[model samples]
Target: MAKPLKCDVCSEPATVHLTQIINNQIHKIDLCESCAEQKGITDPSGYSLADLLVKPESQSAPEVAALSCPECGCTQREFKKTGRLGCGACYETFASVVNPALLNMHKGDSHKGKVPQRALERATFIDRLGTLEDGLKEAISSERYEDAARMRDEIIELKKAMEAAALED
Candidate 1:
């Protein structure tokens, strides 16, 4: 005898299956036809999956045409329409426009990606110290003395913390 696939929402025989990958995690959902219809998943004229994935800034494509990546010659309008960047330089070129959208999509602007348990603390401290150092250098180069001083102090503190952590380990 074959076992029936049940809907996650209502326990009715599942007629549709959906898979979504979010933040490197796979999420699966099963739904009966009726439940799927109620959720508008079955609507032929409704929003497509790509439409759902589009960022809010991408909704107004025409407005973005004026801003284009110098390196790849990729217009913001093209990025909005395709939801993909043309080159690595696109990130730097479009940073101002993309940062807010990225912040809305993720927890923060900085990448706090997964690290192995064995080296987590050291890796984290090193990453933070590196970022602070970079900021310090940029501030100094830009002649922002107050901001440079603050970044320098932060970097020094991070280095001290890293040393303490290493001693404890």
Candidate 2:
């Protein structure tokens, strides 16, 4: 028998799929892919890093606030104040400073968005579009008509799925 179904959006095990969030003491309801896209929302949340880009003269460290690496002679104050590291070792040596700054700017270490799916079909279709389009580009570059035909079919299938997802909105 096939494995039990799971909510494709959130990677949770469930026969039924759902997408929701709690904001302002109220829960945002589940929306299919098209619905969510039409609303420009995602299941996962995201934050802007505009604040991280701030450079106030007052917040700047003192003249002797430099942190020099013993081995590479890199300074911690330079990295923190300017938000630029000279070498890859800076990531390991000064993680404390780098991590919090990133968290403050991005709200998380990674910036990947957790988009909610108000409609699942639309998400699937958009995914398919990427694969099909890439495959078609590759086949055309290699002058392969047969491969192009296969990509065309995949695109058609994706478009159909996208249409179905849109109807859910």
Candidate 3:
């Protein structure tokens, strides 16, 4: 027969196991469910990861109250409390307040990262084809047949390149 795991706190049979790494060191804890709840580790109403990430301690209540999205009427205070934006327009409305936090979280303001090498050619061709198609539509609407024809040819070439890349995959 195997021995039951002992709880670290009270020597009771443990029902929960937790592992954490702090300062490059691994730490393990064994706890009964009740002890885990008492420590806030298993609490349903405890502070969530979103709350911790979005709610900066530097901002005051008055500042939060004054900031709101013009389109959706979602206040910064509401976002802080709920850790979510009301709509996509809220991003533009609250860009000044959120940009710094976003930059910090993503380590960059714009995406200048690398894509998978295998799909690079196909992805580039598809993006260019989309752009060309949009230009072709604009040209046709403006009654510029020459420009529209050029854009259509470019789009066809890009589609051919995409197909070739797909076959090579």
TM-score, model 3 to reference: 0.40
**Candidate 1 local Cα displacement, residue 148, angstroms:** 39
List model 3 lDDT by residue over 102-149, tens digit each: 553445555577888867766777788888888999999999999999
- The global Cα lDDT (0 to 1) of model 2 is 0.53
Query: Model 3 lDDT vs. the true structure?
Result: 0.68
Instruction: For each candidate in turn, give its C-alpha RMSD to the true structure in angstroms.
Output: 13.1, 18.0, 12.7
Clashing pairs in 3: none
In candidate 1, which residue ranges exceed 4 Å CA deviation?
1-63, 119-169
Q: Over the stretch 1-169, how does candidate 1's per-residue lDDT look in tens digits? A: 9988776556799988876664586545567899777667867774332232333453455555467788889976577666567998887777766665455345666676886774987788888888888888898899999999998888888888878877887
- Which segments of model 2 are wrong by more than 4 Å? 1-114, 119-121
lDDT of 1 at 23: 58
Regions of candidate 3 where Cα sits further than 4 Å from its true position: 1-45, 53-63, 110-120, 123-163
TM-score of 1: 0.36
**Cα-based lDDT at residue 124, candidate 2:** 66
Q: Whole-model Cα lDDT per candidate?
A: 0.69, 0.53, 0.68
Candidate 2 structure quality by residue, lDDT tens digits, 45-123: 6311211222233554543244566557677545545445677676656565565545533447654766676645456
